[model samples]
Target: MLEQFGAAIQQVNLSTPVLRLFGTTLALLLFVLVSRALLSKLIRTGIQAPELRRKWLVQTRNGLILLFLLGLVLIWGQELRTLALSIVAIAVAFVVATKELILCFIGSLVKGGARSFNIGDRIQVKDFRGDVIDQNLLATTIMEVGPGKLTHQRTGRATVIPNSLFVSEPVINESFTQDYVLHVFTVPFKRDDNWQLAQQVLLDCARAQCEPYLESARKYMRRLGDRRGLEVPVVDPRVSLQVPLAGEIHLVVRFPCRQGQRSAIEQAILLDAFGSHDFSGKRKEGDEEGEEPSAVIE
Candidate 1:
């Protein structure tokens, strides 16, 4: 009876597919573990540059996960094939139900393909402006800068926006190709008091304050223009006079500056302008409290 029982067990083991499935699963598991260890070792010792190492590690990790999933699917594909029609129907229903989610995914793909922006890029979309700190398939994370649509100063806020905005709204790329950006501000003066002299003083102050960035920006922009087959715009200090209000003249100055240093440069320019002989003894036509124009930087 014991011999017969052992014979029955042997027959059952031979006839069942459990052993084959176990063997295949073990093999795949071993492959995944060995490949991951080898790739990690290679990333640690082979890659020297920090940026390159980071990039390699990310790509390799993602690739390994994808490869493991593919192996599993291939191994169990026969079983999955039986349910393909049901899976397709479910997928279609899910996609139809989650239309916004699908649109966001597709928008992310489009953004990636277009390379419209990258990590650390300063972008403004639909009133949200900041540096992109993180990005994923569904949303983008931004460190808030220039809140309330006021100045370009960082507001110490972090925001997450859906990637679908890339498809629906306009994106303003402030730090594209060149690191330097134009800082614009307006200084107000009474139309009667040394306005021309104030303009000269403002221009000279701008040139003196932003001189360091001019040459470097010119070279960088020249290279960018050559690469893109576009003309490089003049990147020097520009002063223009405009009459936004009736009685005051606006001295608008736009100068090349680093994004982070815009406020500092604006302060420096304002301080210098205030101390200038051109801006002293003002208020020829307007009251000191009501007519005195202040410097507004943006």
Candidate 2:
């Protein structure tokens, strides 16, 4: 009675769906192995050339393996289909859980495709401006730059921004030219001051400071323009006058300088211009307070 009970339980288990699938898979695999062995034997004995025999044997083995995999899929197609549906549902849930992370990854891809900025390049996006120090899939690390745009000085802070910002904001690459860039700054003066003299003083100072590399910068600009089919601007020092208010005048100066030297060059020019007697609107010794200097604007 005990032996009969055990036999009946074993028969019931074998008749279940999972056990039936397993048995079918095993039988299919056995058939594939037998087929492969018979084909290999036939190739080895029938082919006269050694190379041909080896090639046929390899081909037969590969075909049999492929057939075995196909048979497995066919035999377990229902189970595999169920498993695939479950996997897809899990994937959807996971994606919903990590939406921000996915957006960051997509942003990184966008940045790469656009070739917007790179390591050591100065860039500004939205309100953040800095030199890129490091970057990964999730965030970009930059050394903070500026109390403002005119300052062009580092704030000695590191900022890690999420890559997702790249997808929505326009990126300004200050160091796009690599080694040289056109830097602009402004000097304000009172309307009563010697505005003309100040403009000339600033222009002269700029020309003097940039004279050394003016030719190189010009050539670089020309080459870049030609390569990109752009109308390149003149690289010579220029000072434009702007009167935004009734009592003030702004001398806007634009000059070319080496990358990372904009602040220094601007400082040098300001020092030279302010230190000049004519620019300071100060009369020389023994001159009337209201009298203009003997120096004439050329």
Candidate 3:
């Protein structure tokens, strides 16, 4: 192409193309740097529009810099167009060589760039749970929790999930719409114990612990309503005890929790609830607390 187009323009020595390429590249670098600096300064100082603050400068500067680069490239006339077309063909070949990686990158943007989940948001996708540590094109990383406290299968390891998972897996975003989580605890019931009275005592304890969260949920919902155009939600505390599984009464405690604090917070609540209550179906003068001859509910 260079030979074919030589007679259409100024004739040069054997070193002409090399010198022109290097010189044009250097000029482009200088042009880009100068344009970026001036654009950044203008966005920072000249732009006085208060409505366009925080992120306005970066976007404006990028636009100006791109325009400057495009103009600089256009200066080469027809020769540059031919070169650019050849470069585009080579780039297309390169992309075809790594199609999977490009797809992964696009999938990552769709999943992570949507602001769907944050670092501490409690999310369950496929078979993983915990706080997300790092999300990238190839994989999403999480600090796994909840081993045997709630269920038998322990997800105690940091797992890397592929970006394609969002398209297929049912992602349970616990903190997506609400900050308060319902914690259901079930305990065994004894035939000899006064079930109603026992329920009241447990209710009072659960209510006291969950009161702050209920208030928090209300305040958060109101803020969400005002700021994000969301509907206001009311928080309700609930407890259900049922006699089932091996003839044991399950003491269920429903309460609110911060987005990422489910497993640890639940464990803490269980500890405190057990510490304060004598859930033991039998009562003796020297009997210890919560030593009931029934199975414990998670």
The top-ranked prediction according to TM-score is: 1
Summed backbone clashes in each candidate are: 0, 0, 15
Measured by lDDT, the strongest candidate is: 2
lDDT of 2 by residue, 1-298 (tens): 9999999999898779898889998998889888988888888789997645755665576567668878888988988788986699788999999988998988988998999987778999888999887776788888999987667889999999899999888899999887799998988888767676676778899999999999999999999999889899789988887889998878889999998799899999988988764644543455445444233222
Per-model TM-score on C-alpha atoms? 0.71, 0.66, 0.55
Cα lDDT of model 1 by residue, 1-298, tens digit: 9999999999998866756766787898898889888998999899897646655665576567668778888877886888888799898888899988888878888887888887677899998999777776678888898756546678899999998888888788887764787777887877666566677677888999988768998887788889999888788887888888787888898988886788898888888987756554554554444443234322
Candidate 3 achieves a global lDDT of: 0.62
Off by over 4 Å in 2: 1-83, 278-298
- Which lDDT tens digits does candidate 3 get at residues 138-255? 7777777666235312366888877767755667765575555555555557655544445555556656666666677767767877888866654555556677755555566665
Ranking by lDDT: 2, 1, 3
Q: Which 10-residue window of candidate 3 scores lowest in summed lDDT?
A: 289-298
Candidate 3: deviation at residue 114, Å?
4.8
TM-score of 3: 0.55
Q: Which is the better candidate, 1 or 3, if ranked by TM-score?
A: 1
lDDT of each: 0.78, 0.83, 0.62
Rank order by TM-score, top first?
Answer: 1, 2, 3
